[model samples]
Target chain A: MTALTPPATVTADGVIVIDHLTKRFGPVLAVDDLSFTVRPGRVTGFLGPNGAGKTTTLRILLGLVRATAGTATIGGSTYAHFTQPMRTVGAALEAASFHPGRTALDHLRVYAPQAGVSDARCREVLDFVGLGPVANRRAGGFSLGMRQRLALATTLLGDPQVLLLDEPANGLDPEGIAWLRGLLRHLAAEGRTVLVSSHVLSEVEQTVDDVVIIARGALVHSSSLAALAALAEPSVRIASPDAAGLTRLIELAGWADRLEPAASTRPGVAVLHRVTAAEIGARAFAAGLELHELTPRDVGLEDTFLRLVGEGAIPGVAEPRLEGVVR
Target chain B: MTAALRTEYRKLVTTRLWWILLASMAAYMAFLAGIMAFALTQDPGSMTGGAPGVEAAPMTPESVARTIYTLATSLGYVFPVIVGALAMTSEFRHQTITPTLLAEPRRTVFLAAKMLSSVVVGLLFGIVGTVSTVGAGAGVLALMGEPTYLSDPIVVRSAWLSVVALTVWTVVGVGFGTLLTNQVAVIVVVLAFTQFVEPILRIAGGQFDWSEGMSKYLPGAAGEAITGSSFYADSGMAAGLLTSWQGFAVLLGYAVLFAVVGRVTTLRRDIT
Candidate 1:
């Protein structure tokens, strides 16, 4: 999990504001009234399942796909309004879009003039993404990972302030993923905003300081990663010969509201959430139940994520929702 | 537009496909000129069921040179058109437009750049085809002891005009490419129209006499008019053909029509 950083500054420039963005393809709603703000100074993860409209939302922001309703703006204006958009926001994965027959250097060089950057920037960015060794190679012969790197290099050519990357980690190997994480972190550390979208939680688990999670094309959870994990209570697990009695005593001791059977290979253990190990042992001592083990374990974000996306959410906690969406 | 054009120009030269296409088109033009030179060298009496010694027109050196000039464009115009179409549709096929649109998000500017660049390529195609045909045809005519009037002002004007005409035909191709982004579909339709459909319609129009007025407006006849090739009119195979100025106007109209439809589809629809 990422350590929570200081709140990002919401200035008139750099931050991205998505307000009630909606997109409809005939009757199927690709993006449904979605809204979120991606602030600079941190890497923000846009998490959702495969069909949760992650790509659609990103495309809408870049003006690749027009939204049916609402607005997605950067620096208080749409992407099209930017005088030189390549410098305002550089989107990766798009640069991967190239004529396969051209050399990688040729591919990058074509974009240099229009982006208002010098040809040297193209060469520099290729080196930045570790593609300088294969600069003369044809893009068609490149592996998916290499293609991803080339795309990232193109975005850097203009040295844009905000970056929008969609599923950039999809085809990357484990080492590539680690390198990409470090690169993204370094970019964010430079006070540039980075919005990376992926369906897998584990991929962004350690890299993202803040996350915008969605399900069925709507926002479900929006906050820091640590805050989402904190929603799940810390629990203690106990193994005893008299498991039923221990559970009964725990109920009588007033921790019943958060008690659960801890998943274990052995048969005599009940895990409790929001209950301390000391409290359970005290109650067990008073009830005269002998305990073989009393262990405290932390609940992970995986559990919180499952529940957050599922039909049934965690009980008694405020579920994240859009303005007009029903709980 | 200059920046975008420069970018597009760099993109075009980097790819080997464009170079290969240009070389092949030039070779085909030379082959055509060779065949025409051989046929013209044969005895005129042997070519026709002669009434003893009825000569085939005043076979002047200028007329023979004019025939070669018109043949260059009339026979080889489709190649450049296909190249233009492929240039436009290849981006969509490869999905490269995503990045292209991202760098320059405005569709109109990006597409206009493509169009302008494609026209310049079309002009290159014209130069190659015209040079190949005239070079080979004059060489063969000189070998046959026919008067090779390469210095004739009329022949010079027609040859240069044919090259310019070939370039415009390519703009028409760019329109076709944008109108139908599908590579195979555009190729099939263009081939069918130029090879079978238009030829059949032209013959049928001449035979039936009802559609003759419209056949003059067919792309092939308009091309012949622009090149000032009276091959069809002198042969009595076509009548009611438009003047050279009218042909130029009609060709521009077709280009505009193709461009308009393509612009609408591209502008209104999503790149995805």
Candidate 2:
């Protein structure tokens, strides 16, 4: 399960496959020729900007919405084929999917029998999500954060093997977010397949092992988080009192084109792109240049995400890797 | 299937709408039946609004009992229809269908469960309607020193048939609600047709021979025919209507038609 395959190739138990999926709502295309695979025993972040078809893709996978073109399947079968769907795959598409008039316990009770769970299990899940105190309160009176917890509790009624949660942290506070991160990590640690969707990369950065980012209903980049990090340009930052000598050494080595001038407020400091700190250190020593500090700097994932979603410009990133998998 | 049915029932009972509608039906049936019984027994001549030369004919005891008992279907049928329609439409209106369909992905089986639950709710409303209408109407008849006829064979049959008629009406509401899938729109159409449109059409059906032949098949008319008695049918207006069994078949056919059409058309489309 730890083996990380190239983008769009990995498949195993609890894997989700979306192939050539196209959904057109009248003249406007919601999802266009999108394809990706989500593997089990890890948390995969489905990242995209708002209105980028993330919900539409998830809805298609769960059989709530019909696809216009291709297929979305779980474990090589459509969702509707499962005799016990809630047990096989637990999905919470939105927190607002609840009827406001029902109490939290009653809401779970409604689905518990269908999920083949006991009434006791309903109470257990309510407690698990920290909603036990208000289990009998009408959902309409609960706060948005409490409603989100209730939605999550409903998904856990079956203790499903696969979990799909979209924007699960939308209404949560900072503490609630931290709690969710811990909960997601715990769920994934149990070898369950977890795919969570969000528009903000940083919001899921600490939780996701892999990411499948899309924009305008198309796959932008799909790879392990480490692989995506490797796409950033390596650079080195050096500060020295003998800045003139450092400049001359860089000029003589024909590396001046990659050098960015030091900040005016902080003289005698420069950053060199496309080079490691070790290389800069060895060259500076050879030229007898005294360096006060030398550190490697890698661009953060937030930058990469913004660039992928067409939200910002990030120069020097390689053309995103693409693979066509028909299956 | 059993699980789906249980879940559907739980979904219905968890809300206050069903009982609220049931109570309203009971109250409305009692009031309508009591007033009708009083008018019929106290001054039979006033039934025609005292129109000149239009003397109200003296009604038999059996006919009076049948008319009073059948009010459960003739007047209170709309309650079960509303109850049944809301059973399905609330899922859409509240967006609860997302979680519901997620839990049970087989759309057909989900709909089957909804239909079954509608039958149960319909039966419940039928019982409430019957007890209130019969209890109040019979009390009025006794107060007027008239024969209640509560145990008369035809009168008894009318009471039971009224229950069956209300049950069928509930199923009809479910079918149309599924086809429409919009709570507000379904309720509007149901209220308009049952309260205004059908009454006018049924009355107009009596004015023209061509329309009268076709009007007997309308949903409300079929309901009245199934009960085998109604204040309207007591007059010459329902002279050429279909037989009682035929009315049952016609009303049941409408239920099936609405469900099958809804199943193939709107219900099969994407929920989102």
Candidate 3:
């Protein structure tokens, strides 16, 4: 029951827009022609693997890094246009970016004034982030989870309309993660724009409403979580004493196209995509195939992420179809 | 702008570095002034002022007072510079610049606030350093049965100018620190340039009439000139220093140059 700021008025003011954002550090392309929109009232996950330009894109949006080409704006303007940026968009880039010598309160005090906040608000934010008990403790002695909480507290100092967090769940325990998920959902419900970035999709799989994924400095997929899940072909795992006969029976029934050759690692086993377990069971019964085991398997977000990044062996295909992927 | 300044001031006070620098600076000024006062009064002209060709002038009560009161700038200016430099470098050292810029995105305003706040702390450093040097030097002079000359106009002016000089040094530190983002590198450069390189050049400059003209414009000489009373200059060891206003202008020039170059070259660059 850490209470945060009152809900923001529902509007387009907190929307973050990035149009053809490209960044090049000397010879390396960090973000390439990236474009996306994070709207209000939703928890959008900016997902990508490590070095997939997730952090770079956030940095550009925050005005920490200069975009080589294109623009990133919040509320129809660049981050630099805001006089008191913290009040508009509070960002938590890295958790360990605290001065080891400063207490958590002192750290907040340093930015409170610039954010147009009072000293009492610093204490309030520390309390809201569940760090009220250790408000006087130096950040150096705190645990990683505590530091992460401190960073979040710092972002909440101004009660910003938008929150851009980079890997917020990095060093949290399971309980802490659950607490964070609730807090994020609460903030999103408050009509605030929450864009959280993480390398692994599973970490934020349960929390995010929309997903924007990238790989190798280029956009791969951007859609609702349900839309990404729709790309996953539902499959049924089947194991029978007459696996060869079952395969031939399915082939004869014109369901051979659904067979996943990559998933069938051994004889007497086959995985059929886009088919229900009951249909498979009825078909095996009709074919008089000896049954051993049949179970429906749902593809998790982790597999979808790996497949999107061209790093995982897609279900039925021997080679990953990295080219012409959904973008 | 006021909020930015307040934030920068808060940033300085929350850390231990500023107070530590102030304490050390006061101690250094007092000890150095005390030693120089004792040596000068005990045996006049016994020690050479290290001028290669110029004859050393014997110490008098008036000159001794002037030199002692100005020790804060002549010898203790580095402390304020360290204070100012650390203020900027700590952000980089801890990667706190991310949040700092997030709060105030205007780079020029952020740097300006840093400069202004450091000036405020620099003024404090100047007060402590001048007080210690004047107190110890006057005490030593009084112990030697010599007039401390505390109320003399030139002596009083030197004391206040010493404070101003140290304040300017603090601005110089901020600029240098901004230009050199690496904490260790900035510290090393500040210590090296102030302690070894500049002093050697200043001393060697006095050895020749040609170098003397140019050496008087060096940062240390400019600082000492602002006070209008350097132990070396007053004792006839170094000569042809700039007038007080000229010294002030020159010092401010250095501050502006370092700050502008740093702002353009490094401060505006991507902060990753």
Per-residue lDDT of A172-224 in model 3, one digit per residue for the tens? Answer: 99999999999999999989999999999999999999999998778899999
Task: Provide the overall lDDT of each model, using Cα atoms, as 2-decimal numbers.
Answer: 0.79, 0.85, 0.88
* A141: Cα error in model 2, Å: 1.6
Ranking by DockQ: 3, 2, 1
Full candidate order by TM-score, most accurate first: 3, 1, 2
Model 2 residue B186 CA deviation (Å) reads 1.6
Superposed Cα deviation of residue B58, candidate 1 (Å):
8.8
lDDT of 1: 0.79
Better of 2 and 3 by TM-score: 3
Report fnat in order of the candidates.
0.74, 0.84, 0.85
Query: How many steric clashes between backbone atoms does each model show?
Result: 1, 0, 0
Compute the lDDT for candidate 3: 0.88
Off by over 4 Å in 1: A1-11, A93-96, A235-237, A250-269, A293-295, A312-327, B43-61, B230-236
Docking class of 3: high
**Interface CA root-mean-square deviation for model 2:** 0.8
Docking quality (DockQ) for each candidate = 0.66, 0.73, 0.83
After superposing candidate 3, which stretches have Cα over 4 Å from the reference? A1-3, A254-257, A311-327, B47-54
Q: Can you write out model 3's per-residue Cα lDDT over B1-272, one digit (the tens) per residue?
A: 99999999999999887898888888888899889889888866644645456687766778778887898888788899889988889999999999989999899999999999998999999899999999999999999888898888888988999999999999989988888889999889989999888877877788788999998999989999999887666666665579999999999898889899999988879999
